[model samples]
Target: MPIRVDLLALEPNVPGRACLTVKKWQGGEEQLEFSIQRNQDGFYLQDQKAWSNNPFWFKVSRFALAASGEALEAQVGPEVVDPLLEGGANSQFQIELREQNLGHADKGVVRPGVGLLPSTAGGQTRSTYGGVDLSAPVVPEPEAEIPELPELFLPVAEPEPEPTPAPAEPVYTPPPAPVKKSKKGLIALLIVVLLLLAAGIGYWFYQRTPAPAPTVAAPAPAATNAEACTLDSMNSVPELTFVQTCIKAAPDSAKLLEIINQAKASKHCGVAQRLYANRAQAGDPLIANAYAREYDPKYLKASECFPTADNATAAYWYETILAQDPNNAEAKQRFEELQK
Candidate 1:
């Protein structure tokens, strides 16, 4: 026989909350809590608080069930759980059980009662012999009859039904007249003539335009001091003269910022350091250390000279300076101060 599981009650009052308490035959107890919400789609259980406007928002606390054989206990809530079944029948197991349809609007607390087995059943023996005690308080009747009542009669006041709406008049559509093949043929000929004319005009223009004087690019300007100071020159030059020229060309703070950016991009730490120092001397802290100091001392000193005793900033500069010039008394003292 096919096993049937029915949801006896689903109470969806107390919106935004759900809880279930179950007592197992082995004398174990479990509790579960969950939230409920509703949306345009349908009712659903949420792990967190659901909105008040949720149409499906309802709280369900208690549920009742009736089965053919022994009464089974189950944990209920938002979480899914495997159903308890009889005779070790895995196929009969119903999973993810939840209560349903006490009413859509009946949101309230439920305290379901669990029927207990009678003590006389082999004096609470492990195996209750051949048949289970149907009289047990835990097992309740599966069906209860609800009588239907006759409707009350009332004095009738008859009213005529409204007339049906008239159908709309149909619109008359005229069929398209057939085109003259002669006219179509003439139009086709004209289109072909226009295409040929366009092609002829294109060819004439192409021939008239002397192939754009083979654009002879002007010879590149002889490598000047400015061009020579490129990233490639940083390693070749002993003192970074190109970098100094760049600084000279950079007339104001705005230009200085640009030069600093170029130095950083080239990975010219030493040049970047000097650029920062220049910016610091000019009182531009934002540019000095922001890009340079994270590297070695040459970069750090440039950053240190910039005003601003920001602890993290000072720490990096002081550490870098001390690492390179351990004997430099000023650097050592600053390192010690920053460490503290």
Candidate 2:
């Protein structure tokens, strides 16, 4: 039986942070999860299982990684297959790898070791401020000189004769005292008037208020969540959500085909791509071939959801089919064409 490889998720921003699930069916089923990272030389596969300790490094050229396979071994070497098969090297063992969104990985850079090295400390001590004269001597400023003023002569007049002083008594006047009035009765009357006014306003408002209307029950929501999971229903946002939920629920091949047809008719490229990918990853050669054609240079269409044709991606899907059924003449021919 062939090994199954499925790409789970890939980080677009950090392309090296990709996860995959690999399963093999020979000699009792066994599966392993791995986190893939790229370095200068090639790719690194680290087993995600806690108990797994072996990590393998594949030279970039070995796996045709630039064109096809996700984690499959190249025809030349058993280095990749041996580790994956856990020493059960059946001559017939083959791996079908499915990947998506691998174009996000940046161009390779040279990191000479497995995994990422811790960032090194700063190389040299450097001053934060630049071009300062710290050694210059301090200079004292000179004080301003004062000039002497020449003396001037002036005449002084004699004081006027003293006038006779007369003492006048201050006029006696007393300020009027403020009058005090009793306000207890007035305050009490004002309080009583305010209370009466408030009571009258309250009574008026109470009489003017209208009675509550009878409660009319709302009609049932017409089982919106149960709306037929058709592609046409995708136009409704709520129904779209329901459709997505059902897609994830893993509908049968027939249901998937129905949805795929609806998607193509509606020009729902993204939905079609998703359905094709899901089915293709499940070892469905027919679905895989259909998906590969979507990216194939010859059959690809700009009007489809995939506006851009990618020969590399088409080759990858074709390689996946070939791995499963080596005698698939169509996949083999198209794969060779894409390679050239």
Candidate 3:
């Protein structure tokens, strides 16, 4: 039966000058104090007591005897086995070292007596012999041999001859003469020349044609002070100032037209009044009337300046105003009168 010992259990006992205290689990607690001291080459436990005849189980609570002592548990056999006595002179107990497979946090079991024994000197412990064996056998070599060669040979054969015949009279024929230069080449050359002449004439005509008198620069009109003053007034006023400015600056401008159209459509009375006043000052009675109708469709003053004598225009404006503001009794009456 092989003896097992936890190599990890002895980890605390590795460093030189360290003390370990082993506590036996069997009955009255017995403390085994061991000190790790440097021998000739390596470190070994020193000052350790020999085991008693009893089969005692012990654990190393702390090897360094530090505050948190490490535990190394072991089960010693019943025999008074002195490992130092077994291994020759000057040998120490080879604590049969093996890693503990202690599952998880549990400490693993160590079986002693299976490991190498230490050498002893005059009843004192000396050598440790727990190393593994690694010896193997060597193979022998074989002898070499030479190769052989072969011979060669040759052979011969015979030949035969034949007869010949006479030649016949020679025949000759002349090749056709080369052709003369034709009119086709002359015609092709004429076509090329004509094309070149036509191109040149086109270029000359193009050059001669004075590029239609470089468009006459239209004369800039004189600045109208009245228009400028109207613009200034339009800018100074709030609400409807944009519409007023548009009318003053560019009456026909689409944006301004849209703004006026929208104001009329929405029946914005204040905007319509401002628009009418601005357009009236701008000397556009037709536009003024159109805008005035947005506020007071029955406004006869605006009707009086109607662009069309048919009165249909005024009727349309009146109807539009009445359509937007049905409560406008004045617009309704004006519309009736215009119909008459």
Candidate 4:
């Protein structure tokens, strides 16, 4: 069965997804472009169907890393996927195709409606911001009125004559006395009017009052108790936090590169490889020499520990050396050797 390789590493990228590029090699020893995908529970290079092909060997292979993610200048967090269990070898973890064909044999069953891993903030915080509401407040337009039609003229009908009425007796009529206004009633009316007037004025002031100034949210404080990365902390796969600490501690420590290239940095290989890659790209002879000292197969195959090669980086450093001093025999020799 066809197999695909995934090399996980830090890079500058959009959060909430992994950025990956799938490369295909062709005739003339050219590596052609394949698919590039942003994985979220999806495999790179190949799809679920390709992975499902029966009779294929399944292996975790290596936790190979490239100087990606952080190299792209992405901020830390939304951790990298680690394939190892406690003290498990990234390379030693493997199995026959067996029942692994249709899906990941070792992967945990996270059902479709499964809940997210719990945290201090409960479930993941969703975005509070969104596109403008369809019903957002706006100045309302006046409703249109239909035009009135002119009334049509009509003829009036004649009325019939009324019959004579019988005689009726007269009734006495009484005159109404002058109305005397009570002093208490007048006072009460005046008080009510005054109260109403006062209330109206108060309402007017309240409406005219401006809304309180909008408050700005304060920035959260920096975390103090960040995980410390000692040589002892190299047991587990290095996460973004560990990578960040290594960066801040020694942005360019050749000694650290030596440890990492030799696999002495242990599983912190990703972090060390990243740091070394940065220096290797600097094109400085001293830096290159320091790096090449460890990347050389003589030190120990860097590819054995890390998924990538420092030898591939050697050409750049050697070329940089040649550019500075064309007559430099050692640089020329190494550059020529790498070319072969």
Question: In model 4, how many backbone clashes occur?
Answer: 8
lDDT of 1 by residue, 1-340 (tens): 1112221112322211122332122211222122332222233433232323333322334332324323333334322111111111001111122234322211211121111112233233221111112122245577744333333343343464664565597556453343355456667777876777677767766666676677798996744545544555556664335544545444466655665556666565456555554444333445433432443233443332232223333444443344455675755565456445
Worst 10 residues of 1 by lDDT: 82-91
Task: List candidate 1 stretches off by more than 4 Å.
Answer: 1-238, 251-258, 289-340
Candidate 2 lDDT trough over 10 residues, lowest sum: 108-117
lDDT of 2 by residue, 1-340 (tens): 2344432322221112223333332221112222323221233443431112243322232232313333432231122322332211111112223222222111111111111111121221211011011122235697644333233232333464564464586555453332112244546566876777677767766765778868889774632433445654665544224334445456677767777767777776545654565567557787788778877879976654566566656776787799899999999999888777
TM-score of 4: 0.31
Q: Which stretches of candidate 3 lie over 4 Å from their true place?
A: 1-180, 203-207, 211-298, 301-313, 320-340
**Candidate 1, pairs of clashing residues:** 12-107, 13-59, 13-107, 13-108, 115-138, 116-138
lDDT tens readout by residue for model 4, 1-340: 1112222222322223232211121111121122222212233222222322233332322222335422111111222222211111212211111122333222111100001111121222321011011112245698754343334333333343453453476555353332133445556677876777677767777776799968989785632322234454445434434444444444345555554554443544445544444444434466556555554443434443444344434544565566577887877777667655
lDDT of each: 0.37, 0.44, 0.35, 0.36
Displacement of residue 291 (Cα, Å) in model 1 is 6.1
Give the TM-score ranking, best first: 2, 4, 3, 1
lDDT winner: 2
* Per-prediction TM-score to the true structure, in the order listed: 0.20, 0.37, 0.21, 0.31
RMSD of 4: 18.4
lDDT of 4 at 84: 17
